[model samples]
Target: MKEVYINRISKYLPNHPISNDEMEGKLGIINGRASKGRRIVLRNNQIKTRYYAIDDHGNITHNNAQLTKEAIVGLCDDDFKAEDIELLSCGTSSPDQILPSHAAMVHGFLKNGNIEINSPSGACCSGMNALKYGYLAVKAGQTKNAVCTGSERTSSWMMADTFEEELQYLQTLEDNPILAFNKDFLRWMLSDGAGAFLLESEPKGHLPLKIEWMEGYSYAHEVEACMYAGGDKLEDGFLKPWSEYPSDQWSKKSLFAMKQDVKLLGENILVKGVDSLKMALDKNNLKPEDIDYYLPHISSYYFKESLYKEMIAQGVEIPWENWFMNLSKVGNVGAGSIYIMLEELVHSGKLKKGDKILLSVPESARFAYAYALLTVC
Candidate 1:
């Protein structure tokens, strides 16, 4: 098989870091140390600080296209022109517009540079899926080089005002605001960033990650509607796209509102996520012991213990010390989390040549799981 190698990666984080204590005031929640819900979320997620693309006044500092452009710029070399990119894959959980695809907008930002553009928009797993698509294309000799990117402005999605308005409406109906909205839980969880990778068939003047295998799976039915953003739940228990729903419901805030079932998420992600990882490893005839390092994009530290226990049950004995994670610093950047985590590791100067790294990603909204293995060169 013709091997595909990821040559380099570029990551762009929008703004200054916001600590948990600062987030309490920024989010307008009273007495964070006293609120049981806030404390549990903080304790469970273990996120200390995260970056936001919005300003202190809750205005967007950068749009999706600008963030994507910055990440793409990082992928360029003085030797390689932007046009040399044969394939471009852009993945995101949030897009700037509904008409022109996010990838198309990125292409436009590059002076309308022409190249085959693929935009995979969905839950968090969309990033891994986009990377795999580009990798497979390069491996098949369809493209000499490809750029795979995952970017998110999730802070824009979980804005406090949106929930405040929703709460006001729910209160008018005499409904419990806390029960009607989950924004308070999510407001402190998701952040914003963009990351891109330059992939080629052969390495050039840089260490390339030789792709081993990549696969994706889903068990949506097992944990349906556990986490979701954008769209209205219907009478049939399905969600109607926000665009299809009445505009009045989103008059002030058109961005998608996220609703999550925290209990179900805790019960499902680790258990089902490991099962999917085992399947991927099995398909490649490899075992957990064969993996040298685990680069898991954990949504929170709450699952760290469960993940270890589950991996052990599945016969993989990799230790906690062998795992690479940045959730504590970056929080969860939606589809971009895995890409940023991978970039941090590559730039950290911690890996030796021939180290086998396994990357795992799980998406809550769509209940998707994905994994990829690579050998550092």
Candidate 2:
């Protein structure tokens, strides 16, 4: 198979910064240790800034379409005309419109004619999924160039009072007036941001980042573990069970369709993620020591730690402090986290030519998707 390469990448975050101290004040919590601990340990995020889609009135717009447009345009700049682009894909959990998909908005903004565009709703791994698809498309000679982007304006979905109400209900086992006065979890962990990458078929003369190999897997058990729908409805909170209504069986059916290879809450992380990584490497006749950088999904601090330990067990040495940790600056951008990290590495001069990069992402569902070996060129 011909080698696939990622030519250029970029990321954008809004100008504002929301510190833990500011969040503590907003939450009216007297315990500084509690605030900082929640900021670092509980939430597994210490993000300072996240880009939001704001309207002329300066109100935050959580519309996925608007954010997608802004992120793609910002990445393209003036270098390439929209007409020259061939394909565009958006990886996002939040979609602007159900029918048109977020990719359509990006296509409309770019104004590229006769282009094939798609918006992939791959949950948290959507961004990496989009990139993988783009690489395959280029490698298969389907397109000369492709653009992948992930953007989210979660602030629009946040209801301060609603979160508080939900928390109060959980605490009191019923909706109470006292609970209404209490606020939800601090908004520090939730923010808005976007990222984009320009990938092209590596030409004869121009050097580019080469994709060595990629693979994907899915697990369907506990599919109902995570879900979302439009509205301020309170029942859609975390770890809520799938509805008992007959119509809600769709969630169960979807989960049944996605049965994955790994078991739920499996005790072995290295055994699973590293084993998948090894399979990809063995397929390409590569080795773990060949990789120079490992970019695993930053779902949470604990998850990252587990992944690190697993990698270490596999004889891949990586320092926790020196590892590229961006959740502190941008929280979890869902699918965009991996791509954003890669872009940062490139811009900061950390990634060098021929350096191998390994990426791993686990969906909320038990399934784990792993990508191994991207050589920087």
Candidate 3:
């Protein structure tokens, strides 16, 4: 098999990083009522600033496809250019549309020639899934180079307009105008951005990350979805997909708003993450000490200490200093988050040759997870 190396990496964060105090004005308040949970969620997430694709006047600046196109275009240079890309793999939870796939939409924006493309759909783990597709394709000599992207345009989805009707409906029926915690909590937590990586058979950039190994797992059989959108979970924990319901209820009940089972999330997320990491480390014959940097796609600081404690309890502890994270700086971009963190680290001038970096991404949307290892070259 041919060796795969991530020769070039780039990220595109639309517009400026919006500060905490300015979020409500930017996102607007549902029915002109300020969010009751914003302070608490931001305090817990520890995200002081995050980027959004919307401008000051509440107009969208970029959609998911445009964000992705910019990131892929960023990879072009004198050695290997975007014109040479042979495959495109994209991943996202918030796609611009239901059909045409995210990769097709992105390619439309690029105006690049037709090439093989794959769209992996899910939450945060989708990013690694996209990378794995490109890596395996290159390794198998199916393509000389591929551009894989992970991005989200969730800011618009979280806007007040999406929930005003639902909140008003609740007010008429239950005298509760407040948006449901499950639906509204995510607005304060999610931002928007895009990131892309170039996978090549040979290294070309100044410093390339050689693919050591990648592992993925899912606990869906053992548990139900903890985070979701475009559906409503029933009493028996069965997710009622959007198609099964009437189109009228979609907007009336805000059926498409992102929701979370906070209690369920707290119960299973960290524990399963440790278990997944434990199995992967053992199978890869790796010890905690062997990792020089740990880039985990942790969504919020609310889980930071608890996750560390969980890993230690499972005997797969990596010291605090070795943990490389930018959640507080970048916010949670869902599938785009892990790539965002890597882009920051690569440009931060911190990594040296021979450094071993481990990536762990766990999604509460059905408890799926992906782990990968890379060596700096």
- TM-scores for all predictions: 0.91, 0.75, 0.98
lDDT of each: 0.79, 0.58, 0.91
Q: Which candidate has the highest TM-score of all? A: 3
Q: How many residue pairs clash in each candidate?
A: 0, 5, 0
Give the per-residue lDDT digits (tens) of candidate 3, residues 267-297: 9999999999999999999999999999999
Full candidate order by TM-score, most accurate first: 3, 1, 2
Model 2 residue runs over 4 Å out of place are 23-58, 77-79, 161-188, 203-207, 221-272, 314-322
lDDT string, candidate 1, 245-276, tens digits: 67778733332767776776877888888888
lDDT of 2 by residue, 1-377 (tens): 55677766667665455565554333334211233334443344435554444443555554666556666665564566666678788888666555777787767766668888877775666777787778778888999888888776555444333234334435455442232111122234445667787777763323357777777765444233322332211334333223433544433222111122122334533456665665666677766566677677654565666776776777655556446656776666766677677777777767666677777665553345657467777
Give the C-alpha miss distance for residue 134 in model 2, angstroms.
1.5
Candidate 1 residue spans exceeding 4 A from truth:
24-36, 179-181, 234-236, 251-255
